[model samples]
Target: METMNVQEHWQNMALDQVPLALAGHEVPWVREARLAAFERFAARGFPTRRDEAWKYTDLSILAKRASFAPDNIPPDAPSEAALNAWMLSRQNVHLMVFVNGHYSPELSYPRNLGPGVQLESLAGMLDENAQLPPELFDAVHEHTVLDALNTAFTTDGAVLRLAPGTRLKTPVYLLYIASGYGVSIYPRNIILAGEGAEATVIEHYMGTLDAHNFTDAVTQLELASGVTIDHCKLVQEGSAAFHIAGVHARQKAGSRFVSHSFALGGKLVRNDITSSLDGPDCDCRMNGLYLLNGRQQADHHTCIDHQAPRGTSRECYRGVLDGASRGVFDGKVIVRPGAEKTDAHQSNRNLLLSRQAEVDTKPQLEIYADEVKCTHGATVGQLDEDSLFYMQSRGIDAETARSLLVYGFLNDVIERVPVSELRSRIVDMVLDRLPQGESIKELL
Candidate 1:
């Protein structure tokens, strides 16, 4: 396949959005960071199949035609009914909503976030001319091109800061919705949790059924010693949407970070997740599930670095591919030298439901420490024919039996979700993707 050069097109798009981007009350450092990142993106352009990190995915279609930059503010906020229909099953929490990459105060309800807790819109703070910290712009210097692209055009995102020893009774939710066709959006979120702080944060991205939008988002979390954060990212975009997102986190000594990702819809989607255990006695967990059908494509890339002694990490990801869809998983675990007493494990399992469906899975472990215990593996297989035959012999229909087997394969990952209601919703979505899955609903 031949590829087209898209650097000039993306650069031109960046140039067109320059005024609208700077029109916000951006600080000197932010302005400088944006400029530097734009320069990097202009030089690097979009990643191609040649790049090692992006070998399994292609961006030529995205680059051939430039997408429009959405308005800084939504033309109209979604109605209350729309909000209720799209919100999470667990609604007793602090919520902040963004429409088309811009903050929507009319639909947000983040009052009374408890003492030592600060939850607000990042775009609002900038608009109020508040001087933000330098680390906020630090991600603008990311090594990846998509991340740099996000920093160059970021308009609005959520910011959550937890002071020392603060623990919220409920979770904090950031909801992003896309409905504008041919529009490109960038959302940047930051979470800073001080020592001994605890919280649950969920970032939900929703797209209408007929949307043809493009979204590029980046989230960064900085956890102090003794802090525990449970983070969940839910993506249910339109079937024709293009979504690219990354979650990068850094944890100090005695800190714990758990992340759950669910990818249910998109024409083309990619998720990049990285966790750096920078201190001893830290714990990290990465769990994900993806379902694809038709001609959709989904890819997941994860990196866990144990930089200190006595660190532990576990990663488990599963994917279900149907029809002519494709799935990719590349997970890397690094145990740096002097990071002794580290225990790490990673696994990727994929299931193909049709002959045309495909998967590429790679689990990598790089260890520089002699006293570390590291393991990595991946498996790609189809439904068990013998098991199906046995079920058929037991008076079970073929389609229903296949659906039951897939449900069983993904049951463990669903069990890992801590939230009861959320897990049930995830199960429902999972069933929707399986053939005749609804027929076996009552049996489960």
Candidate 2:
């Protein structure tokens, strides 16, 4: 992962046609905002390993290449059979589909939504309502180099709003499908749930199983007082693709936000999550799982900031690495000076399945308040050979027993997912993708 060449590529790349990407659109304001972002992206260029946050996962491979710019994609309707074959049909949530970062209304469905739920594509919203929030266009995050990059080039995504006193019985699915070679696209999304609102949203990122491409995405969520949100992400990219994503959340008094991130694809992947409790009684939960094999890389960075009194945050992330793959986890929790009675905890655990596999994990706690409780821990190791041997002695073959034990070890985190359909599917999916899993099961 070289750095000098990527910086040079960003410096020399031309942005002459950036305007054409959004030309003659119905909304002048949104177009103007993207132009400004592109300018910012051009000015900052790509981030290097010298940066503290990104030191572990190098961006040289991505920086040296020129990703495809955003353009209008002709809508490709998903046939009726395709819809029926959707893996997550059991969820019964509102569904929205985007192809190559462009929203495809034809493939989306506005399901049996509650009274106060509003789901629409960003482009359509901008065209319909001229008074969209101006702050949305503002650069909310510039601390990391990748944040700046995502802000500068993101094109099409969806915005979801749940009005006050609204409670949704079903989840909302915002799915993105990337299909093509040498393609790069960005999806920037914002979600706002008003006071006392309750909703569940799942953002799914799936591409052609073998496509060569890159996806850089940003998602911001705001939970108002007394609001509760359950957000989940499932990413499955190809072996030749790269994935970079960030999730930023802010919560108000008496609000609760629970998020789960599952990463299981791409040649290289990274997910950065940040949460802030700005008022009393605010609570947050951040849970994640990453599975890697071959020479793949998976990284997760998280921060939980307690800004007000009596707020609590709990986070746990786990990873399984096989072959020559590597895994990275860096988590931090902070309690502000005036944040009394703040309770925060974080943990990161990893399992290495091969001699060449590696994992780097670090957890940090920063507390400025006197009456606060905070703890952090990290561990990297291999499976329990004793347990495997015990099972092998009880009429089970060594390989079959090993797979069974590994699956059981991961179930601790996988079972925490609230959605039953997703939980079952993820468990099966992970097992199916593990090394020699299919052959071991057949042998048994």
Candidate 3:
């Protein structure tokens, strides 16, 4: 008997499983694309610690686990109370819910979309017409194995499109819930904002506590000239779950793209986000916060490509790691040649509450243009003892003082969230999870 390597195991899994996964969709191009993606995955294999991009994180545990396939048998839908609780009781929002990568019409609210706005499931679109544009799968770079796996196995996800000059007052919500045990789900989403259109979208991923699950998600967004989009992604999966997600956006001239990401759950999680400024005068802002404790590990990687002149980008990410958890932040900004007058700034800050907690942070800038202004920086440190002592001297308990200081450290990034309700929700979630959170809540 011969032992198989991790890459060989996955390659065999892709070969054996992808055809069965494509049972429902008879689209020729979709099949071709999936096969192509599987080939890419087999060629590149999974990244190792030796790989520069994956230096701080390791996926050996995930790869060694038994191969997981899509859960064809749908589990029971979550109760209304669970849905409402996870949604934070947000009202007047267009909601689309998925359970195990299958769209649930009963749990979704698809009404009142008004004119020039379209929201539906990508799988539904494929069923209606198999001739969708091939560019939908061209968003991410072809070198990533996980992305290729997602492309090969993705069944359904949210699809939103806005016509030119349309404005949607209500935000769109995409909620993904994992219910079954030891299931793998691939979700692929696409968002298109036409010229002069404006809208907001929020994506939420969650699962039952203690359930073992894996979620591989990919999202691609395109903003035409003069469009404005506010995007938020929240990951609150089970403590025993593994999650990997990627978000890619392309911005046209004068378009504005703002993103806020929150990672608060999962035993192991990785988030990759990239934004390309393809047209001049485009603006992009990326903000993220991660909270980890116990044995959890989280990694965030971001890239901003300034491909045109006069583009501007700003990024700020903060993390709080406690217990024996670990965190990683890698941010890169590239100003391509001929992209003059570009302005980009990136910063990553981490706070460790426990001595055993670890964090690796890297902020980099590559400039090929002469007249560009770019700056990058990273900081990792424990909570400020001076502030903690000052609060303790003011009669505050030590635990409460520490919580206050942590909240204060994160308040700056939380305040930058554009949606007031979401910001408040984040604040409540953070405070509820903090050590001695109840006492600090009274102070707030």
Please report the candidate that would top lDDT against the real structure. Answer: 3
Model 1 bad stretches (over 4 Å) = 1-11, 14-26, 68-70, 129-131, 139-143
> Please, what are the lDDT tens digits per residue for candidate 1 over residues 1-444?
222234566555566346246424356666777776666666777788999999989987876555545456565666778878878743577888888888888788886887999887877776675645766566533747888777777888988899999997688888898866677878989899999999988888888856678899998899999999988988889988889998988999999999888888889889999889999999999999888999999989989989999999999999889999999898999999979999998988999988999999989999999888888888899989999999999999998889988988888788887766667778888887787878767666
Best by TM-score: 3
lDDT-sorted candidate list, best first: 3, 1, 2
By TM-score rank, best first, the candidates go 3, 1, 2
Using TM-score as the yardstick, the better of models 1 and 3 is: 3
lDDT of 2 by residue, 191-213 (tens): 88899999888888876657667
**lDDT (10s digit) by residue, model 3, range 238-343:** 9999998888899999999998889988998898998999999999999998999999999998989999999999999999999999999988899999889999
Clashes of 3: 0
Regions of model 3 farther than 4 Å from truth: 1-20, 139-143
State TM-scores per candidate: 0.94, 0.92, 0.95
Q: Relative to the unseen true structure, what is the C-alpha lDDT of residue 389 in candidate 1, on a scale of 0 to 100?
A: 97
Error of 1 at 377 (Å): 1.3
Q: Candidate 3 local accuracy as lDDT?
A: 0.84
Q: TM-score for candidate 1, please give it.
A: 0.94
